[model samples]
Target: MKLSDLIAQFITDQLTGQDAVELQRSQLASRFGCAPSQINYVIETRFSPARGFSVESRRGGGGYIRIVRVPMGPSALLQHTVAALGEQVDQSGAQLLLYDLHKAGILGDECFCALKACLGDQALSAVPQPLRPRLRAEMLGAALAALAAEQ
Candidate 1:
């Protein structure tokens, strides 16, 4: 695993069986033998709302970062995924989002594969290259929103 992945896993382990965990950046940085910015990078990317986490930080008195795992049902995950989609998404980005949703047990095997196929380049062939990514984002957001509505 990469250093970032290790750091992410460590933080995750710390949160196991708990709703939230707090840590000092300097301590985590020293433990990981990296800079505090490195810890920040992991927390920012791996513990984002899209991944079902919310982080809060304090800036004084040897500040600490609090990571809270957001409790979410399948519908909630679907809704969050849709909201996380920005104005555009490449094929890989859509795949990663779908994979995350699937791994969370919100999407079954059939649904995951089907969604991935639809988001692939071939599926969007009719869309001009320049417009494909934006179209994919719109398509995905709409699909997820529709699913969320049903749930």
Candidate 2:
């Protein structure tokens, strides 16, 4: 593995439980003798849904980067959901799925809120429209998986 890849693995290894929170990207970059952007690149390229991992980032001071490993069951579900999303997702179907997940207690209120924010019509009204549904699905799936793994 490359140095950055090894460093990323080490960081991932350190996250043992759900309560394990975000890691400082700058700190990780310094530890690996790389730029912060390099760390971001590594995360974007290597820690992806297909690889069974998801990453969340924040900007500005005290910001952090979170990497969550998706459990096998949810990972499979997410894969299937992504495949099923195809080009677009009807709003009603997305809402229904979200409702089902919320009802099942698989997604908590906070997660539900975040997912809604991402999938809300206003948030998705932008260029490259075809990508929104798939992105929302992927984000919701990852967020749910993270919540499940954490609990």
Alpha-carbon lDDT, every model: 0.87, 0.65
lDDT of 2 by residue, 53-151 (tens): 666789788889887776555546455445434454545546655665565455679876777667776777883667766666666556655655565
Clash totals, every prediction: 0, 0
- Distance (Å) between predicted and true CA of 84, model 2? 14
lDDT of 1 by residue, 1-151 (tens): 8999999999999999999999999999999899989999898668865578878899776799999988897788778767767799999878877887787777789988999999999999988999999999999999899888988
Weakest 10 consecutive residues of candidate 2 by summed lDDT: 77-86
- Candidate 2 clashes between residue pairs 3 or more apart in a chain or in different chains: none
Superposed by TM-score, candidate 1 places the C-alpha of residue 114 at a distance from the truth, in angstroms, of 1.2
Error of 2 at 101 (Å): 24
> Listing every candidate in turn, what is its Cα RMSD in Å to the true structure after a full C-alpha superposition?
4.0, 11.8
TM-score of each: 0.70, 0.47
Regions of candidate 1 where Cα sits further than 4 Å from its true position? 14-45, 48-50, 54-67
